[model samples]
Target: MISFDKFYSLFQKNLQNLYKNSKEIESIFFLLMTHIFKCDKTTILLKLSKKGKIHFIIYKKLIKKLWELKKNKPIQYVIGKAYFFDMEFIVNKNVFIPRQETEELVYWILQDNKNTKNSQIFDIGTGSGCISITLKKKKPKIGHIYAIDFSQKIIDIARKNAKLHNVKISFKKVNILNSDIPIQKKINNNSIIIIISNPPYIRISEKKLLHPNIIQYEPFQSLFVPDKDPLIFYKKISFWIKKKLTGIVYVYFEINQFIYLDIIKFLKKIGFFNIKIKKDFHGFFRMIRAVYYKKK
Candidate 1:
């Protein structure tokens, strides 16, 4: 067994090469301790004050995770879980980890439709089912929620997350880019329809701008788009709304900040008016919402 102070010192030293900030290293250390020991921060601090010792088996696990961290693996992936909207989600290499920006996107939807009843929500390119699951959990009055992804493996992970949240989301395996529309069930024409997506908007050329934790660990299919068509997924979703969906339709996207204007322009061209862009906490224009009203 190793004393907590000694183990923490070793942990800080191993993480220094990966994280330049001392506070970040300490934060990660506490996070690891709490996750591994299934205890809270106060308990961890109390143990530390008492000079608690870590069992040999737990020490070995921590060392292995430290090695992964040294490789610049995201702490979320290292722990196999991520927190989003105050909810824990199961994540793996097959699914893109949820981002705080995406949580803002979810909140935007909830704020707009809090009083809405019998609404159908579709989460296109749903990853880990974070957006749909959070919406379902927070807004139980929603009529139905559907989540779609191309990879069956990714869909499986999303299903697991939905199960963990104890929410019923209709998950489907369908490539948004494919010509065939995946949604086939008949819907009430008067019900509000909301479509939300955080699709692959990062251009292939921009891959170098991302960190190793993102480019090396996250699923490639969920992140990159061809440089020539950074808005492919958005375009596809727009066309789907135009061709397949009806009623008072509200569309939301977690957009690439660099292409916010371009996305707004495309949505306007596709007959979606009342478009709005929201800046995230980082002050980047990272989310958009638009509404389409059916002609009388």
Candidate 2:
């Protein structure tokens, strides 16, 4: 058995080399304790004040999980779940963890559609189904929500997450990178079409700047684009929209912060107007919105 203080001391010492800030180490420690031991901060503190000791066997289990952390495995992957856009999602090595920045993108969409009703939505690269599921939860009146991903393993996780949220979404396994991939079904001509995507936009050359926790644990294919073609997914999605849809189509993307201007330029070149850019919490221009206007 070990007292909570002693256990915390040992944990901090073990992770000292990995994390430079004491507060970061402490925050991760509490997150691990709450997540792994199923003990919230108050419960753990109360127990520490009263019982003071944790079972040696449980201590070993905690150590085992922390060892993976030392190896740079993300806490969300290690625990098999992540919180995104105010909802909990099941995540694993097979799927990319839903990010807080993407939550900003979701907030923008929800805000824009606050007055909309019975709308149709298509979410491309719906990793863990976060965007579509959150939209359905917040705006239940929206018409059928459709999501697609390239990996069957990722789609499986996304399905489970949608089920967990008790939101109905049509999930499809399709590689949007394939130019020949057709839209699954034609949307109603009069229905409002809202497209959302957070495709892989990281340049391959920027891989060295990423933390090991991301590169080592998160799925690589979902994070990187060829250095020579960082705009490939954006271009493909833009071209597909032009080819497939008509009437008013609102498109949203959680983008690479550095390429916001390039996205605007590309959208203009492709005949998309009413372009808007949004900043993440860090003030990076991390999201873009545009509307395709055509009179029929």
lDDT of 2 by residue, 198-269 (tens): 999999888888877899889988999988888999899888888877789999998988777888998998
Candidate 1, 106-169: lDDT as tens digits: 8988899889888788899998999999998998887698899999999999999999989999
Per-model CA lDDT versus the true structure:
0.88, 0.86
Q: Pick the candidate with the highest lDDT.
A: 1
Worst 10 residues of 2 by lDDT: 179-188
Tell me the number of clashing residue pairs for each predicted model: 0, 0
